[model samples]
Target: MALNPNVPANQEQRTDEIDLFELFSGLWAQKWLIVGCSALALLVATAYAFLATPYYEVHSILRTTQLKELDELNGTGVYKIDPEEALRRVGASLDSYETRVSFFNANRELFEPLKKGSGSLENAFAAFNEEQFTLLQPDPRKTSLVPFVGLKLEYPADVDGVAILNGMVRQAISDEKVRIAQDLEGVIKSRLNVINRQLTAARAKYEASKENKIAGLKEGDEIKRAQLQDELKALRGELRLRRQSRITQLDEAIAIARSLGIVKPTTPTSMGQDAGAAQGNIIRTEVFNQQFPLYFMGSEALEAERNGLLKRRSDDHTEPRIAKIQHELQLLENNRQIQFMQSREDEDLFLAALADLREESSRLENIKLDLSQLQLARVDRPAIEPIKPIKPIKMTIMALGVVLGGMLGVFAALLRVILRRKANALA
Candidate 1:
């Protein structure tokens, strides 16, 4: 041990080389075992590649609907659905578990493979949905890309994947159409109900106003008639009093004319009644004036007026206001405005905007939307039958098997060599 301090560096290098050579010799001795393991692994990989069930992948691309395809829906103005929204709805349906289950149930013949397992049909479908179905969409951050949504499905080669994917897309479009149509119908019905209620209210209001107007007319007519009757009665009473008074004045004038022995209208001078001048009485009083009393108009004229007044049967024609009152009362017998309102047959005419509303409703009712050919989303690429299986890549599996066999062979060889040396040293 003390003499090892003087050993050259070259000697240590030779010792390391010998140890590496021994390691190579030990691996060469178990070459047959390593070959056997590699061959066995390669056999298993080849068998699996040929016997395993091959899976096929099918994909479809969906784009937003075009504006021209949605003309009928957008033209209505009352209800509208956008292209982006329609595409989004289809994508959502594709991602829905319920939608997938419904499709599965409706077309059970297509999903027969999922029923082969020991688990229930629902569990199989859940597994299939989780593993086999994929939803693809453009990344929001990728601005240069045209936005699109797609469905990817990987299924056993025996299944008709193309039919399944295309059918599902068609079903989603049909369902969206139905939903839009129902929404439109519901809105129209609600609007129609509101319009009908408004019409009823308008009719009721018109009837109330008509009744109020009729009542007011009747009241006014009664008041005017009563006032006219009162005025007529007052005029008649005044006429009667004037006639009686004239008769009394005529009687007095007659008495005075008879007592003076006057028979006709005459001046006092003409009758020589100026006694102050006839008796030569210069200082005697003399009355000089033109107008005289009603009696002075002469007893013959007064008696004639008194007899005419007494003979009068009515004084209605004497007052001009009485004739006017009677005419107004006749006019009030029936109000023309109220009559016009009551005699009308159509209550709808009372509502100002009723005609316009009816026209709008009729237009909406007549609206013809042909959704049989409505396109909710555009199919950029339809699913096609795949020619090759995407799983169990044969060349890659075989290569991995060779590498794994080599590793396992080397580990066994090293362990055997170490164990054999220890046993030899013990002996």
Candidate 2:
């Protein structure tokens, strides 16, 4: 079979190859140009290394010992003045890039005056305008104020520039911490005072209501007069005395008859059995029974009434009265009970008040304990602490010089080639 003429170009053998030796020989023809470029690059790199300014960095470490915890059940976490992954969240916000920015902005005016004094005002402002002296720090979301910050100050190193940078950071951090401490302390004291005053007032009101309920119970009722006592049955000895009163009444009646010349008392039953006599006897008996008792009772009652009554009453005796005065007494008793309940409620309220007061007292006591612990944590805050040290860096100034010098050498060689080509064409 014939080889397929339609086979892809990849199957065919390639003719071109990179001639490394020939290329090297061609470059050697311009060896002096390459050497000059290399020499220029070395000189430029050395000058740049010597001329660059050195930067000094000073840092400070800050942490919040009183960082708030979300769970109240996790008691004394803040008191421990300890850090955790949770504490790191607020720690990140405490001050990160923001603190550095504020520090530079606040001292901007101060920097200008110093620069003018050092005769570098024009140069300093020039650098500032060019965005060379920009202050930078890790974003707050990513940074923890724990161990430390790599605080930095980049200025043309000379005279007191380094000293001022160091001083500025130290003074700023110290002032910020003092202000924070005083603010936190004041907040605790203020809340404690308010709670104590409320507790005292509530306690006093509760106590007074309890005492008044006890004193009002002993005084009895005042509803009826003494005359109303007659409706009740007389006592046993009293009924016996009434029988004796009937005998005395009989004796007196006989005396009256004797004084009228009849010695014996009239017999109401002695009348004959004939209709008129029977009727008269029945009438006399009825009269005797009814009149004798009425006369006897009327005489005694009249005598007593005359002696004791200031004026005769209307004699309308029945007033719908309370038998035991039980409901009225019950009402008064209910009033007493209500007062008792009020007193009990006062006691209960005071108990509740005491519970609340105890809670507040316990809370304050815990805060006081926490404050004591925090004071120590504050002391351990590092001064001008460093998290990472900056090392001397090699600049790419030499690399740029080498590249640019080589480009110039190639351009000169290209000109020489073009001139030779033109002269050969002319010949």
Candidate 3:
């Protein structure tokens, strides 16, 4: 007989192929085994459900409030807290070993029952677990704004978990407030120091310029001229001093605004119309100072001409020449006083800058007051005692046990069939 070309060279490969119906029938034949295993698992699950200690979860909702006032005085907008970042920080803090120990100590009454003999306090402290605390940001999807955060604590039902969780939240908020205040104060002080240094330099420059100008003038018999020069110098010095003072005040105001979490407005170079006029006056004074020597020389030439007329014994010429010389001298004196007028113009500029600084400072002070009064975190919902136990859900445990038992039974029945077949093939 000729061997069929379609016949397999290895019959073992065909034997390895599994039939679903046959496997199901094999399992079905051991129905009592499956039922007995399932019943044993159910009994164990029921025993565990009754014996395990129940846990109660207590949770609270906290809403972060405005640490700084709304509508900043400097028009920079209000400061906002990042809820997600804050939650992460608070979570880490609560999970710390030190924090957990502190929490347990603070609520000693709650954990007293957990204490065992002579080392009761030590045992109680050891019972504190970082895992018991949880911090969650409820609306993570709302990234545009920080959402309210939730804090939860889980402990045995016998413990006062609600009180412990509430206390922890309050302490965390207090620490946050202190941290923010210290940071703001440090930044403001650093900026204030820089402004102070600039102000000192400006004042020194103004003083040095005033002294140099006064010392440069030559002494002469022109008493009126001397007096006018002194007055003009004094006026210029006063104007410069005022300007420096106003700048210093403006810096202080800006610092205050920054401390309140407000964007500090740019320090203005000019205070509107008055500042423009002051700048113009400064330029005009510089030009006049340059031309002062020419005016003085002209007055001296007129005086010499009048003396020559007197020596020639021409009364008519002498009288007219004297009058002309007097007129020229008066005009020269007026021109010299132009510097004093310029200084007066600059006074208005300094005054305007000072006014602006004062207004800004006042607004910042008001904001600071408001912030001091505001609370950092408000309790939206205080934690309460949980109504039901959270752990060892009976129904879920029993269902899992039943499924596992059925799977184990089917596996065992299949293994028995495979071992018998292997033995027969060996024989």
Candidate 4:
């Protein structure tokens, strides 16, 4: 029983070997079919390679502008746009779909090929962005390399991609320049408005201050004049009372003198002695502890003094302070400082900051830069016509076709062998 088990194993191994041999022999018989299919596929691929539409790729590179190139723009105080920012703006404009559409619409003749077979202008342009136009930039992960942005356009041999790329770049630069100029103008206008407002306020403040000063001066003058008038009135009243008291004392003393029969002025010693006994016309005065009465003078003299006091026209002339007050009031009638300020034709002279504001405004107003000369971005490399088509490679397509054809032929050969085996078993 053991010897019989080893013999069955040997027979199964021999059957597997025979089956492998038959499979190889069947595939070898179908070698011509595989070769024929491969040849047919290669021919079709060759024909397609020569007949298919070839697209050419054109590229233009843009770099940041040089510092010296933007000197005028940077020098302008109102607005400053740097080279990197300018380059970024241009790149943004180039990357915009709207910008691409605008360029396409403007140069319809140049883009006539894109419109072909496309449903509408929108669809054609949309397809154009997806297939033909490409926005390129340096790798962000690589920091050591100089940053640059590029525009790539792939077009058929019938279209001119070079002209389109160059035109777009120039248009983007021109648009950015216009935007910078407008921004500068807007800033200058806003600053000018602020300066004008400040100047107006300063003038108003100056005029108001001048009027206030004039009013204060007038008020001060009135107060001073009033004080002088009060002092002068009090002095005049005191003088009038003193003069009236003297007149009353003189009247009483005159009656006393008339009762004593003393007509001329006499001293107390004379009143005791006889006036007729007096030698010569020389008058004798005695020093006494008491003050001499006003009646010491003759009646005629006292009457003359009283009459002069009553007939006096003005007391202001007698007081020095009254004359000084009148002089000060006359000066206040026309203040030189107030007149100078009021008559000033140029108020900016007094306002030191106004001149500076005006100068700044004038500088901004006179700002003139040749925007056409400004360079928004530098064209590192201009677009050039492609030397070769970037389409379906003939060699690659033919190779793939050969491989696929061989695969199909082998499957057909296997299926035929299996069907023959089943038919044989049925028969």
Candidate 5:
């Protein structure tokens, strides 16, 4: 009846090996479960994929080029609402500032164009420069992600998902919003026209309105223009004196000093603004190619080298005057570079100012044109079409439900097995 300790130890190791084998064998032992689970997983997946609701999403992308509108964002942080502006005007002018002022005053017919209501949007909503774009929808069910959620909704298998998505898009371009936008545009055009007429009449009556004001503005502008030009000319002269024919000598010094590895530098630049409105933003980039390594040589040497190169001096290496000219030349080139940078900075400032003034001028001219057009025009709304039923997509939902059910079934089985093993251990 006495068991050897060595025999007990070997028996324990064998039991562990057998347990491993048994665990390995269970996958086959549980073959029925594997089949049942697989079938259940498949069934669940089918129900979800087929019976589930399909969802379609839609989106519109637009960029605002509202150039001067930057002032709204930066200055006041107010978003522009075209419809809102129209309504405000309509309300203000309504009933002659009194809701009960007069029947004639309350008459919206005369002011139909100015009406801020959704009705007005029909005629005058402005369309900016845009390329007409179209997109095609693909069968997402084939590789549907997040299908389970759609499946859970039990979305009608025959439910038209595309129709639903299209409806949302149509909602975005809401008829009322579009109508109101058009109306607002009309009102602006009308008001802007009135202003223009008043301005024109005033100009005609005053005869000296534009000329007088512009003359004064121009006088001030002229003084500033002259000052800039004078400074620019002076800077150019300074630059020329600094470099001129003296550059050849300095270049040799830079070549000799290049081995010292001082530095090569780059600076960022914006293109000049002469390209015009039709070009939008096309610009030519210019980069100055000047390489100055160091000022090891003097101006006197540079002058001698220049003279030698020009054949004005004999070819002699022992010329003591060369060093003196080289040093002077180096000083001159430094002065020239400084002047050149100063000129560049000045030009950039002037150019930026000119661009702003020009842009403002363009806007003013547009306003004038709009006012004139308003005086001569009327806008009409297009006919609206009624909504129709959307098409159904059943396959989308079934695929989704299947994948979700399979995952859920797997987790549930895992949990059940863990619990059963724990219970057995306790028993």
Candidate 6:
């Protein structure tokens, strides 16, 4: 009992060191017990792995081909629905509970096999929500200009998950097509309405101008008469210029035709003195007939004449025929001027407005064609049967079990050693 303070402190330090070493040695002595506990945990893990049902996943790819860029109609740009955005909304809609419920309801038989343990359709739907569904675009983080998306479905290994996914994809595509058509139709109809209104306004303006009668000379309005005279003079000048241009075009066209051996004179040898005169007359007639066939005859008659003319051959009499053709062309120009002079300013406006309305009508027809032909989205790749189950990775589960079981066993052994030490101390 007469121990020094330094000796007691040293003894306590030594005891602490021994206790630390004894902990490891104690665990070593009960290594077999630890191994047995680990073996039991491994067996439990194995049983759970075998008992759990495996699930397989199948996926399909979709492509959005809707008109994303602004569409050009009648030289004006119009907005169109973005295909990528529409596809994104469709994907989001698929993820919604309501859409999923609808899908389940529509194809209850497909989901029925998934309801092995479920009590009713609702419970089956609940089970599906818990374990079977995922709809998403692939690689959303990556910036891609292409509108590619993916839909995935998981089910029990025995179920036809691929068929279910395919059905869903088909339904989605049908719905999107209908939506795109309706939207495009609405846009086209709205634009048509606007164009019609504009046309109406233009017609009204033209009618009002006619009622004002400012385009023509009135009986007592001297200033208006002078203005009409000036307009008439300008019209005459333009008509004369157009006539001259037409004459030139006709001359060149006749020369080209003569060069091509399409125009000819029928010379008769029986009438020796009249032969040259007959040839000249025939050439003039042929030139006039070819250039202004529709002027004298109906379109059908003109076509018939053209067919007959095509059968005839001609010799090159370019130098002598030019003067005669020029004379005939002058007569045609004189007739065109008479018709042009008869047209009033109001009549010209009306004709211009009519042309515009016809153009608009043609544009509307094209829009209708586009609506009918448009395809918004399509199934790029269909889902197929999965070769392997995605779930219940046995190796991973076994490895996890081994590591966790070993740690728990070690903790149990340490606890046993500590309890024995306490019992011994109490004794």
Which candidate tops TM-score?
4
Q: Indicate the worst ten consecutive residues by lDDT in candidate 4.
A: 11-20
TM-score of each model, in listed order: 0.83, 0.45, 0.47, 0.87, 0.24, 0.54
* Candidate 5 CA-lDDT value: 0.39
Give the alpha carbon lDDT tens digit for every residue of 1-427 in model 4: 2334535777545543436667778878888887887888888888888888888888999998898888888787777777888888889988877677777778878777667663776677687778888898878777735567889988877778889888877776777777778888899899989989999999899778778987887688778767767776787787677767866777787777667666677677776766477767776767899976766766666667767767877666666776776776677667687678778897778885787888898898899988999888889999987788887677888898898888878887877766776565345
Q: How far is candidate 5 from the true structure (C-alpha RMSD, Å)?
A: 39.9
lDDT (C-alpha) at residue 143 in model 4: 79
Candidate 6 achieves a global lDDT of: 0.63
Alpha-carbon lDDT, every model: 0.79, 0.46, 0.57, 0.78, 0.39, 0.63
Clashes of 5: 31
Model 3, range 106-202, lDDT digits (tens) per residue? Answer: 7777677666677767565565454576676655455635457667778886677877787777666555555555655554555456545655555
Residue runs of model 1 more than 4 Å from their true location after superposition = 1-21, 219-223, 226-292, 297-304, 307-313
Cα error, residue 218 of model 3, in Å, equals: 6.2
Q: Quick one: best lDDT, which candidate? A: 1
Candidate 2 local Cα displacement, residue 268, angstroms:
8.4
Tens digits of per-residue lDDT for model 6, 1-427: 3445655667645543438678899999999888887888888788777778888888887777646322332223343456676577567655666656766778888776766553876887787776767766767678877677777888887677887788777666555556666765677678778878877888788667655554342323445445555655555566556555654555555555455343432212322445365545343322232343222323333344445445434312323443454454444333443344456555535545678776776766575434333454556788987787887877777777877888899999999988887666445
Alpha-carbon RMSD, each predicted model: 6.4, 12.6, 29.2, 4.3, 39.9, 25.9
Residue 299 Cα positional deviation in candidate 1, in Å, after optimal superposition: 4.2
Cα deviation of 80, candidate 6, in Å: 5.5
Off by over 4 Å in 3: 1-32, 64-134, 138-146, 154-159, 191-195, 217-373, 410-427
Error of 1 at 170 (Å): 0.6
Worst 10 residues of 3 by lDDT: 285-294
RMSD of 1: 6.4
Against the true structure, candidate 5 reaches a TM-score of: 0.24
Pairing residues by index, what is the TM-score of model 3?
A: 0.47
Model 2: residues with Cα > 4 Å off, grouped in runs: 1-30, 56-82, 85-98, 101-156, 159-292, 296-355, 358-404
lDDT of 5 by residue, 1-427 (tens): 3455655766645543435454445444555555566567667666655555443332222122233423332222112443324333322222121221232133324323333456442231111001111222225657733111110011122333333323322232333234444654565556557656654555464435434654665565556556555655555555455453456646665455454332332122321233254266555555568743333343344445555555533322334444444444444334443344445533324232445544543453343222121111011111122243122344444455555655565555555555565565445
- The model with the greater lDDT, 1 or 4, is 1
